[model samples]
Target: MTTAVLALQGAFAEHESRLKELGETVIELRDSDDCALAFDRLILPGGESTVQSKLLKERGMDTLLRRKIEEGMPTFGTCAGMILLAQHVDNGQGGDTQSGALATFPACVRRNAYGRQLGSFHTVDTFADMQVPMTFIRAPYLDSVEDSVSVLSRVDGNIVAARWKNQLVTAFHPEVDSDTSVHEYFLRM
Candidate 1:
């Protein structure tokens, strides 16, 4: 199956490399036109959520992506991508709707919920078949989600990974390491 990674900004290249290792061809997505015309599955990589959202808006991908997701196209979001998919975002930064998100998942999210970049580190979690080390950088801790969401992994009692329908999100960077199950799972969908 062919998968596309939104290459508007961020660690999209890393995601591209990992998916290649799984023997799947990837399309580096650009613009709403590309999002609209590209493959069935898409993965939005981690980056500055506001910046990425602005880029998506500028490129006209915002509407296209939302439409695709509603049409049942499988999507996987990491870090900032996860932030973008939230139904609500913390109003901590003066309640700017621009800081708001796509409302893809039924919930709220606070950017940098984990802390600063220096606070980033690795953790081995039990959710995967084997212990997998995940890298969290300026990550967002998932506070609440609807019943449709299933907790896939956690760290220190906080949910770090979860799934809703064909959509999956992780606060940590699995692509930083050598795991393909996550990407493979999306492919299967």
Candidate 2:
């Protein structure tokens, strides 16, 4: 299955490479126009959420993405990507650039919740009993969740991984470890 990676910026190459290891072609999605094709899934890589959202708005991809999701497009957003997919965002200390998410998943995310990039580290967590070694780089910890959402992983008592409907969001960069099972799951979605 072909999956499109939102390659506007950030660590998209890592995700692309990981997905490629699964024998799938990675398409760089620049805008809504890119979402027209019958892609099996979409990946929004971890980056700066406000910046990515601005780019989506500047490039007019936000509206297109919302429409595509409504049409049942399987999606995965990591880190900052998770902020874009969630329903709410608390920027900590009541200071935030954006408040709400795309509502793709029921969640409340806080950007840089784990501190800064220098605070990034690795952890071995089990998702559905699957030993997932993840690299948490400037990640956000999930605070709240909907009843239907499944907790896939966590770190320091904070929710770091969850699945809401067809959308999968992980606080760490699985791609950084060159792991593609996460991306593969999104593909199968």
Candidate 3:
């Protein structure tokens, strides 16, 4: 199956490498034309959410992407990607950014809830019974998930991973690690 990884920004290359390592055909989605390509799944890598969202809309691919996800395209979002897919974003304190979000997943996310890039860290955790290393760079944690959401994994008391329908998201970057289990899980979904 072909998987399209959003290449507009962030660690798209790293995700591409991991997906290829798993023996899957990968496509780097950039514009509307790339969005039109036939693919079984999509990956939104960790990066600057505001920048990615702005680019998506400025390039006129935002609506198309939202349609694809709504139509059941299995998607995996990491870090900033999770923010893009979230229905609401609590910008920490008590404010929200309404524009530019894809709003596919029924959840409220808090951007940079773990602080800035300097607050970045790495940790090993159990995901689906398999030990995996997660890298968090300016991560955005899920503050609240709707009833339709399934909590996948958590670090400390914060929700880090979850799934809603065909969409799966993580507050950490699994692609930055050597392990391919997280990508494998998305492929399975």
Identify the leading candidate in terms of TM-score: 3
**If ranked by lDDT, best first, what sequence of candidates would result?**
3, 2, 1
lDDT by residue (1-189, candidate 2, tens digit) is 778899888889988899888888778988767867667788889988888888988888888887777677788889988988888888887655354436577888888887887989998887655787888888897888889999988788899989877788989988888556677666776
Those runs of model 3 whose alpha carbons end farther than 4 Å from true positions after fitting are: 97-100
Indicate the residue-level lDDT of 120 in model 3: 92
lDDT of 3 by residue, 71-128 (tens): 9999999999999999988886657456326889988888899998799999998776
Candidate 1 achieves a global lDDT of 0.80
Clashing pairs in 1: 87-103
Query: Candidate 2's error at 145, in angstroms?
Result: 0.5
Q: What is the Cα-based TM-score of model 1?
A: 0.92
RMSD of 3: 1.2
| TM-score of candidate 2 to 2 decimals | 0.93
Per-candidate TM vs. native?
Answer: 0.92, 0.93, 0.96
Please list the residue runs of candidate 2 whose C-alpha ends up more than 4 Å from where it truly belongs after superposition.
95-101
Best by lDDT: 3
- Clash count per candidate: 1, 0, 0
